[model samples]
Target: MALTDTAIKKLKPSDKCTATRPDKYSDMNGLQLWVRYTGVKSWVVAYRYQGKQQNISLGLYPFISLADARNETTKIRNDLAQGINPKDERQKAKQKDNLDFDHFAQIWFEHQQTRIKPHTFKRDKGVYYNHIKPLLGDKDIYTVRLPDIMAVHDRLALQGKTSTAHKVIADIGRIYDHAIIKGLAPNLANPIPRGIHKSLVEHKSKHYPRIKITELPKLLTDIDTSNSEPLTKFGFYVLCYTFVRTKELLGMTWQELDFDNCLWNIPANRMKNGLPHVVPLAPPVIEILQTIKSWHLHDEFVFFSNRGKDNVLSSNAFTVALKRMGYKDKMTGHGFRGLASTSLYEMQYNPQAIELQLSHVQGSKTVRAYNSANLLPARIKMVNDWANVVNEVKQGDFSTYKAKSTADGNEMAFISFLQSLRYKEQEIQDELDIHRMERLEVLAG
Candidate 1:
């Protein structure tokens, strides 16, 4: 017979000189109220799975009442019928409790070390140590939800470390993804969901702040007149005219240059995107290259370090030059690319040609290869046109350039050519070129 609430309430422990042994009273569906002779009461379920008897604890007396205990017992009997052992399931859950976020993050970092570049590995390690491990490290990864991760992200953003916050979310997501693949946290959702940046306030997203086109002439003049070393000045000009990345500009070898073809072919290993990049040498760029070659005579790299011949220039060399030129916050070595890109677009140059000259990935691998080949002639013309603009900046400011909006319908040509190149209407309108339509009208007039 099933025990009643009144019977359980009236029951009392039998006093003894030693600790009292537990007494079991069975109810329907493998449920039992186990009472100690000392008066303590608890609930348990006894069942047989695969021909063996097993017991799983539910909880204490009043907390897990007779009804609740019976409900749990029915669930266990259902498990037994399905050949599932609740004891083993509980053990698995306990194992997951030991798998915390920090433990898994360290494992993920160790595995990634062998796959990525040494510099990249070092940078990622800094991100983990500085941002991620402090807050979520000891927490169980399975228990970490979106709000918990978002709290850390928001804190970093509030401190104006927006890029760091973005990186933290990405790194945490990668760690969780690795955990799932390794069967560590299979059921836990990634706290940092995809496209979460859409929800975060968009920081201006300037990797390097560049000056406006109209401001370029003064900057160029300062660079030319600055008492910095000739080699530094030459490197600055090469960076400006080539518009290559700082690392690409610093790590150049004479062997990579084909003066006859007026090109510099950056090998795949040296390139960030792991594809060979070709930089066209305009006349002025070639002059600066020749000057740099003369200074380096037998040196392997064009820009050798001041400390030693074998070592290339320090990465901070360009930054130092920018500071000397009073362009520390106004511009950067990377900013040259933005300056070149903006000016080229506003000049109504072909977008594909400009993109090719910049070595930006245009499309699929086969498409990129085809575009690289087909885009060369157009790139040569585009680079020369860009060089001419830089030369004009070196010459003087634009006080003489006049305004005429229609330019005999040449403004329509801007819309047509940019549209043919597949630029969206809004994107075209947003370009600095469109904004400079008034200035361009003055120049054309």
Candidate 2:
């Protein structure tokens, strides 16, 4: 007999515990509402495919209501009419859950290699092969639970590599996401749980080695006189002047420059933050670029290699040159970013202008979405001020620089700093007086 919700609720557990006749209500088309002796209710479907009978459960009881159960039965009857067996297809999906994680990770890496930056992919590849794959490669993706993930984190953390431990787990999470998106593991969740790193050692992000702003003069002297190739030599100088990331500097193309507007518009893909950045070119950088443009070596890349199959210079070009200039393990290409940001803030420029110029992703999502070229004029002014310092230091002059401690918003102290840079006392006084009256008139307005 067919089943109804009211009658199914009144049904009792089997006295013989389903050992006698089947304790189930057979509805129609081999579909039955099953009641175990322990009072567990379930909906089951029985069908024939290739002349063999098969059974599968739709779901468990009041959860799978009468109409829902009937709907599942109708679908199973339709599958039998089409000669398709649900049980065999179910086995195929279960087999996919047993897929080796290493095999799946390879597919994910291939997709990433063609999509992400070479350097970024290189880092992820190293982490996977060195740390993650060794631990999780032999296991099935579905079977990698929190304990297995914690093992990967603990192994690296034991070596005092907390930052790397954080990165590999993120990579593992991304790989699972790729699998799900590709329909390989459709019903599985990412094994790397979120916020799992909080309970263990707090990840202290590492910074590249840096030199103080006072060291710029000697570094500039070495860069100008280095025996490196001309593009690489001047590329280091321009890297200091612009302070863009090493990759962004190397990946610059001739078409990205706007000489008339004095701006360099970096495209979204090249930027680490995946947002387009506008670099205000100072007169000093423009002079360096004009000199590079005069080389007429490669029409495509601004910094092309005379020796590489890719036509552009290698990514490690700066590090190699820095080491050659006797700055190994002391100052890296990324150090210029930290140096410039600190020096600029010390110079009393607006902090927002400094951060946006650095291409840092900050503030809330909504604020970031609307802030594509925020603080343009302030950034232009700040970069010009910074470039003047670089240009002077490039010419072997260190007297023009002022540390933050010596000059912090004091007119007299600034005047004394200018005097120390060899400005005549009277000239400094006149300049300050002119600006002071201008400020007064502006305040009156």
Candidate 3:
């Protein structure tokens, strides 16, 4: 018999009640809600599970109208008719929706931001936004397969973005695995198949090309003396004097340097190792800083960018200068480090000193800590010698060059020897600083 309004009002407690329009009121029995005994009406559904009575609420009255309640209840009745437990089915569906690839990927990206370095995070974000998100943003977790990932790779290859496509695919696989571990998604299969990328695309080296140490002098001499920008010229000089990374030198500020003390304090954030490094200023480095100071004291950065309002100079400034000077292939901003390292070691400077200056990690747990003392005096001398050599080479004075072999059987005979010496000192000083810091920890403990 069809349920009427009068019948519903007359219905007493414990009376088994169901709407005649059960098909129209399916969700009411499936969904859980609330009701009160104070004549305050609410929607609820009663069901039996394994011979035990269970009651689930649909919602409150007025908000959930009679028509809507009937519709909800009818859906649950259809599920039950098919021998499906409406409650369990609804829970499974909710879980499946939450485990969708796009949903899990957003959560994965947020968690990854805290784990990687800032520069690395920036690169990953670029890959996500430009490649991965566009390709697989709407796809379901179960639907994504190896073919889909390979398709993305092929598309990127066609667009000349092979490297980025590979990275995006790899990142997607990682995000999927992360989701599976957190129980947000099912562990099905990694879409990125191994060897697929290697077979389809050619792998390219990421680092800048290293230049021959001997050719550095000729390269420096070839730079245009006339019509060269001061910052560009000064930046080259700084690169030659200090064997620091391009970003490190560009980020340098006047406050970090102590001219009277002959020291430059690079903060921890800028350093690759995330530790503060003190660079002992050689006379040439001091002179270069003074020269730049004479022109731009208003700006806090030692190397101010004329292109921007900030202290940082454009990254391409040095590269452009090299190109203009016709040394495009012969010398790069990073090649200066190689040039300095090789030259200094040839001059018989300590290997540890050179490695520390390059900021390379020493192979030991104890060596990596803050216990090392920075070899300030040795580094200062090495840098000063490097500056003298650079000046001589620039002025066309490599007449007294002699080739010599090191105790390790490595040959280090070249005009770039002094340039190498400056970097070697930096390396040694870094190790020493670590040792010193370790000692301090012991004392404090």
Candidate 4:
């Protein structure tokens, strides 16, 4: 017979002297309420496992009611049939309670800090604390469902923050996947779906505005004759010759250049892809650097600010100079990259050599390492040929010089021709400046 709640309440304990052992009233198979001489009542289960009789405490009476105790007894009977101990399962549950989502996420984030760049790590940590922690921080790792994660992701999309939403989803999946690998979240699938990005509108890639190759000569001539600072004029030429990004060129230091070897090694942090890039110096680039070095030798930065030697030029300074020269939106500081990439490909240079000089990342890690090591010779020839082709663009003459595309192309012959002309013009500008200074002094006298 099963025990009723009223009948169990009415039962009294015997005196300690009379009944030394506790009295038990059975509800059904293995579920019992044991009453002590002191009137303390508790629920217990008795079952046979591996041909051995075992007993486990469920809970105190009232907290574990007669019906609840009976339900637990049924679950324990199933566990015993499956060769598992109910007591051990309960202990595991208690341990899992400590490994919640928030706790494990912090541990995972700390481990990630050592592997990624400092700025990237800072950004990820900001996202976790600001967006992720508030929504799913307290969820038990084993109990977090797919729908719960989807709710957070959809909310971000609705708020028009698709990029953040995408990163958050990836971050959550990574954390959960790590947890699963460590055996901390068994039987719990990663809640973030693989096709989650499909739900949000994709971000479009932006390309900078650039001039056509035919019009490049006119633009270069305007830059050379512009009434702006001489340093600004040289800056425009360096961008054309090197085809490096604006930040990489503007922040260049004197120490980064190897004039003897004709190479410029940009450091990892300054590069957009966070890798060191080697640029072969063309004759055009070397001439511009030599001119700037003669004028600003004390400054550490190649393009030092007008205000002080310790400071570098402003990022917007070149853009403002372009607008003054009437090339607003016609060309940008970044446009040189596109212009060079397209023209070089048209000129039939090696695609791999051009890409390496542009510092564009491609191929697998192993393949990229091999390609980077062997690209220097090809790149040196490519840069020299490109410089020679651009050097022939006279202000009034639209006739283009067809560059000789060969590994052994001679740009030195063209460089020599241009060097004599450049020196003659420099002498004329110097004489004019001196004459003007003398006239001003004569007027003062």
Residue range 286-399, candidate 2, lDDT tens digits:
998999889897898998886653578876888898998999988998889867765565456676676678887768877765664557888898889888877775565544
Candidate 3: stretches off by over 4 Å:
1-97, 158-162, 186-202, 207-213, 272-275, 309-311, 370-377, 399-445
lDDT of each: 0.74, 0.75, 0.65, 0.74
The residue-by-residue lDDT of candidate 3 on 1-445, one tens digit each, is: 4444454444332333333212122233444333222223457676766677665555444445667777877877787788777788778865667646666776886687567665566567667666776777678877888777777777887888767766766788888788768776446666666666557685343435555445555666665363567777778778878888888888898899988899888988788877777777778778878988998655688877656434468778878877777767757888788777766755577666666677666657567443236555677777877777778766655432232223331233322233333435454454335434433332333
Report the lDDT tens digits of candidate 4 across residue range 187-297.
767867678677756643344677766677678878878886777778778888889988888889989999999999899888988888999999879988998998854
- TM-score of every candidate: 0.65, 0.60, 0.63, 0.60
Give the candidate order by descending lDDT.
2, 1, 4, 3
Residues 1-445 of candidate 1 have per-residue lDDT tens digits of 8988878866665553224467778877778888765455679888877788878888656646788888887777776677779887767865765678887887797699668765476678777767777888889887888888887788899999898888888888999898888887668667676788788855544446777666677887888788877777788888888899888888899899999999999998788877999888999999988987776545578887746323677657778878887888989888888777766555666777777777777679999999898888888877876777777756754432221122332445456544544666666676535446635543643
lDDT score at residue 336, model 1, on the 0-100 scale: 89
Top candidate (TM-score):
1
Native-referenced Cα lDDT, model 2: 0.75
- lDDT at 145, model 2: 90
TM-score of 2: 0.60
Supply the TM-score for candidate 1: 0.65
How should the candidates be ordered by TM-score, best one leading?
A: 1, 3, 2, 4
After superposing candidate 2 on the true structure, give the runs of residues whose Cα lies further than 4 Å from its correct spot: 1-134, 137-145, 158-161, 171-194, 364-366, 369-374, 394-400, 403-445
C-alpha displacement of 158 in model 3, angstroms? 4.6
